[model samples]
Target: MRSLAYVAISVQLFVGLQCQSLPAKVKKCHYGDGKCLVESANALLRNFPKGIPEVNLKPFNVLPVRDWLLVNDSQVGGAWYFFELLNQINYGFENTTITEIRGFDKDPTATRIEIHGKIPRLVYKGDYLAKGRMLWFVDINSHGTSESDFLNFRFDLTLKVRIEYRNNKRYLKIYELVPNIRLDRWIMWLDNFFPDNEDLTIAINNLFNRNWVEFWNELEPGILSLFETVFLSLFEDLFEKVPYDDLFLADEDSK
Candidate 1:
């Protein structure tokens, strides 16, 4: 019965999206105006959670992930770890604030765009599996549920785009997206690290929460890659539906 209800809801959402019109609240910014671009970005972020149904985008407040694996062959504190998160749900992107926009005033023909933004907080809850050897002696293996909070999360994004002519209209295609992400602090909780030893599990959880910076440093690369993939897909979805002229105002149109 639950599965049937879910399917029904999904179908209703799809039908509603098909009947919607382009978002009227979207404010097109002048091509070379940094301030306007920043404002436009913030506006889009505010609207992202509810989704732009005209573009077939779903709500982005909660992002679901099947699994992510991070393997570190190099030693950190004389230890190497393999970590994986499964069935994860990440939240809080819709509250992001655009701090600055750059590279927008470059040559009119330039294909690069740079953006900087920050989120007050982001939370992730999921199942985690990890194993590692420490100091060539302690063998660690664990699997259970985990929740992690990222405070003051910030990111710098660089996008490379190409112009596409389709149906006599010009569209932007994102060819590459690079993201640099950081956080002021991380708080983590993991259950059942050592299934047979409750005290050991508590100690391990404490150790991770106390020294999250080290763990974040080790996890940064994988996390950045994950963001790139997710954001790229989102950008492509929007760009494919909205023509370039609809997103940015031309010189004469700006006036």
Candidate 2:
């Protein structure tokens, strides 16, 4: 695919705020893949095709949203939902709730990471929810010995998060984001025309799923360019209803 160009869309014009100041290396996450988008009823619906949803400048300056992610629904006081994070996301719950984690059921440390955030995982301890009209924070305090580089670092960070109901999924820049469920089906349909070569099936599936990263890497530059244009476009369409936002993470465990 073409390298993401030096594209710079104004936050105020497109998103309407500079929630946080981000480092140059950070790239914003759009509303697709890797789980974690929000379910805001018609909030996303109003933003696409029919019209642009009004930006909630209430939390006006959230910047550097890292990855797509949402606190597990079970812990969000109700239904199942997710938030998107760009990279890895870490959470730090409030101490007041440290002894009273009533919102979440399982212990954060003990719960199994089903898909490493590709799937829903509870957000219990190290983070705060963006509900009830108050600003919440997620803290990242890590130590790299001074002998290595600058001073040890620790600080509070803010991120954009959303609650997305599976039934209520939506996306920005897209109207519908149902996965290319037909891609595999199409391959199978085409396969019927080919002989029943089990080896070919295995090879193609492997090429498309497991090794596709490398496979994509080897595509002619021109082909890759076209592929990304079509691929990201499709993704945006399929998942258009999910609430979209960018998040920033100082480190993996801090997301």
Candidate 3:
């Protein structure tokens, strides 16, 4: 009787594993159907904030970044700057809206997917260190807490994936990810810019805010690289647990 009970438990566990394929909330799209793909992708994003336990994904609403650095040695407005941020917490991705999706209509064997999206606002809080020289005369050195609010940020994401066979099922393995990001406006505040001089700190903050475009031009590369790393990890976690066949159903399969 004990041996028979052991067999029954084993069979139950196997059946449970087989049933845990994809999250129930995920709407499977037909292969090469862009409209359905968009809807499916949006549904997936909505689930990402709370996480899909079936796929073993974690909440990504607030992502933590260790550190990032930007250096502008070349002359720009008669000033050159070096900035570094540490222990950053980026917020607001849970509010993202996918404006367009492309390359999904390509052949199933194709390896590329392009996605465009916007985040109404992104808030970053971190510790910052900055050093710079202005007008070939004035030198600036500061380190303190900083907060930046980016409004109307848009991004174009490209994902490169390859097929892999696991347990006789096909799955997508994301090998590379690239992102192009743009911001419409920025609000920045840094504490202790001049160390105990409130007036200087306020002035410096205003200057940075007013000239944010130039600053963004300098920071864009670093920002893109950061997003590439973060999103790649996020996608890998989702794709590895889900089979390709489960994600995009064929027409007959949909029926």
- Steric clashes per prediction: 0, 55, 0
In model 1, the runs with Cα more than 4 Å from the true position are: 1-21, 72-80, 103-111, 135-139
Model 2 scores what on Cα lDDT? 0.25
TM-score of each: 0.80, 0.18, 0.80
In candidate 1 the C-alpha lDDT for residue 250 amounts to: 67
Best-to-worst ranking by lDDT: 1, 3, 2
Q: How does each model score on lDDT?
A: 0.78, 0.25, 0.78
Q: What's the true lDDT of residue 195 in model 2?
A: 30
* Candidate 1 to truth, TM: 0.80
lDDT of 2 by residue, 13-63 (tens): 343331223223334222231232222212222233222222222110111
Q: Candidate 2 has what TM-score?
A: 0.18
Q: List the residue pairs that clash in candidate 3.
A: none
Q: Which clashing pairs does model 1 show? A: none
Candidate 3, poorest ten consecutive residues by summed lDDT: 103-112
